[model samples]
Target: MARGHWLDPLARKVLQAMGELPPEPSARPTPAAPPEPPSWVVDVNRASASQWRQLPGCSEAMVDLLLRLQRGGVQFSQAEDLIQLLDLPPELAERWRPHLVIHWYGDAPPQPPAPPLDLNAAAPERLTAALLWPADRLQRLIQERRRRPFDNLADLQERLCLPPEVVEQLIGRVRFGERRPGPSLPPGC
Candidate 1:
């Protein structure tokens, strides 16, 4: 018998061994639906570790650090408060900022906005505000600058006293008021 002719009987025997075969055609192996994404809930003052972990793009380490900060009597008054904590990355802090809630303490007066620094004329406050460094770190940077002004962009990179990535970020955001005739001025000049 022809090879093609043998296929029909083989198919029949296989189907018969498996009990009654279907007369009509049927689709096989339906596709499964995609899983739903994790839901996010912003619980301002009382968010748990599990809740923090649910945030999109948050890592296990990041969530643990956030919970630790929360448990250490640190109340997040503003989204930017995360920057004050040393463990959290600036990028992750900024990303999760919108999800945080501010709980008003009793009789706390509305705080005024910090004055903007003149990157060209003013001190490290300009850089600190722009780069999100703590006060002590900012002071150290300012002290370093008082010794000598930065001669060029490379000098700024060398003496900025921040994480290299943060220095890069500051470099991007810094708006030089006017190009000094020669090179970039160092901090605190």
Candidate 2:
């Protein structure tokens, strides 16, 4: 069978001698596979705007629409509530259903209140931050307040040189003497 007749046996002997023969069984038992991880769920009601946009098939525009609904005093009780409130497309709703979840906290994120700032008690910084008034106008208001607290809306308008429209806007948050300032503007105001 020519010179190659002994080569196969020689090779097998070499492998056997070198302890490289066949696939050797392990000395120790194999470890069991690690347990599978728990699946993730996104709570629609509690998630922030950015988090909402991170869901499967979510879009920024859709998130903006949801935010608008939220700001407009809409409360979503569940994924269905969000779908209905947003008037989501049927196909889109189906796509989102797999990932959407709702863990209802005690309540939904509160809508900002009308008259969210108190003219009489709010600091210059609050007026600047909340009212978004220019510093000069805020300074004028501060100057006027130094003399006495605002007696009423008209007094504020007169002293602060506020326009009628601006006064209308401020009417919600402004308060006179004993009344407590509310946290938000009135709905539909």
What Cα-based lDDT does every candidate model obtain? Answer: 0.50, 0.58
Q: How far is 1's C-alpha from truth in model 1 (Å)?
A: 78
TM-scores of the candidates are 0.31, 0.33
lDDT of 2 by residue, 23-123 (tens): 22443358999865436555664567877876666778767655544443334444654664345789988867776775644534323345445567787
Where does model 2 exceed 4 Å of error?
1-112, 179-189
**Best-fitting candidate, scored by lDDT:** 2
As a whole number from 0 to 100, the lDDT of residue 98 in candidate 2 is 71
Clashes of each: 1, 8
TM-score of model 1 (CA atoms) = 0.31
lDDT of 1 by residue, 1-189 (tens): 553323476686577557665332332446898865434546544678777776657677666655543443334445543343323576766666666666744344233244423345565555765657777866665664455543323345445534434432332234334434544444342
